[model samples]
Target: MKYNNQRPVVIGVTGGSGSGKTTVSRKIFNELSQNSILILQQDSYYNDQANMTMEQRANVNYDHPLAFDTDLLIEQLSQLLDYKAIEKPVYDYNLLTRGTETIHQEPREVIILEGILILDDARLRDLMDIKVFVDTDDDIRIIRRIQRDTQERGRSLDGIIEQYLNTVKPMYHQFVEPTKRYADIIVPEGGNNQVAIDLLTTKIRSILMQRGNDKIINNKDSTI
Candidate 1:
């Protein structure tokens, strides 16, 4: 049996809740599709809430790193890096449960993995070639999260505030903020940091272009 270390490039972006990791990931995905790209959101890997009753789920602390199934996530990511298709779990925040369904993703030249705790997990962090941390003020993040949850996730203002005050803020200080040291790039102000985003996009383009050129010479379908 043979193992392959040379796999698709992986980028990991992590940050505190509502720090704009998702926004950055989406932007990168949109910009990098010329050579095909797969985006995996760590939020989708949240542990299944099926075992818990509605009340239990309601009381669950989602900000904890343990709330996610990191082993499964790592396995799926490794498969993608090996040029294999993977069915990634889809977590529903509104229902506070992991659906039976998953999104089937094909291997691509680039894979962007974004989440709050991406850098916190040592095993997963080792997989990323480029690691980014979005740094935003806690007040700003909380405000954005409240708005996002209320509008997008169907959460009430009171509920959002309660969760942030009780679970999100403390967990961020404990687990997320300290992981900033691991980032190759630190993006401040989340999605509003255009300069940082552009720089990152350019870096990605250069890598893809270089690799694509080589692949083309080697008879690989180079679409970049």
Candidate 2:
């Protein structure tokens, strides 16, 4: 399939775990042309732990920036920006390691990179045209985390609580929260912030339109 010749616009959405950044990303995505957009989750790039035992994997501090295979993520994202397809990695929450399957992703006009620690890395930040941080209270975040982990991730309530207290909470303060300063936009209520979502959607559409105009001009100049 043919891809847009113009470079893709990359939008980075980052916030603490359970801060509703995914929801915000989805809202922005749905508002735009779905055919021209792709959402890339940072969680999908978790470091491979195949060499480690289950016990070792389980003990890993996943909330930390060091837990991500950021080099691979940057490489794949750069490929996408260059209008190349990629075999994106799949992360298994249950196994605490990379999954056996790979997802085939095609290049798109717009890419939304969403994750808790996406903004923590300078290389990732440099790739983004727009940087957004979804700000939510810690109390609400923990509550959401408890519900999501228990229901979707098959995590025990005790384990979820322990992980939150031991790593997730502290790591958020140390790494995730600090990245908010890098954001061009800060949505206070995540997906619930309709105004912010609408504004972002409008901005992305404008960028896409500009790219389309540039492509048209380039094609005309080629004919001349």
Candidate with maximal TM-score: 2
RMSD of 1: 3.9
Sequence-dependent TM-score of model 1: 0.90
lDDT of 1 at 59: 84
lDDT of each: 0.81, 0.86
Worst 10 residues of 2 by lDDT: 215-224
lDDT of 1 by residue, 134-177 (tens): 99999889988988888887888998888888999999999999
Q: Highest lDDT among the candidates is held by which one?
A: 2
- Stretches off by above 4 angstroms in model 1 are 1-6, 212-224
Q: Per-residue lDDT tens digits of candidate 2, residues 73-171? A: 999999989988899999988789999999988777778999999998899999999999999999999999999988898888999899999999999
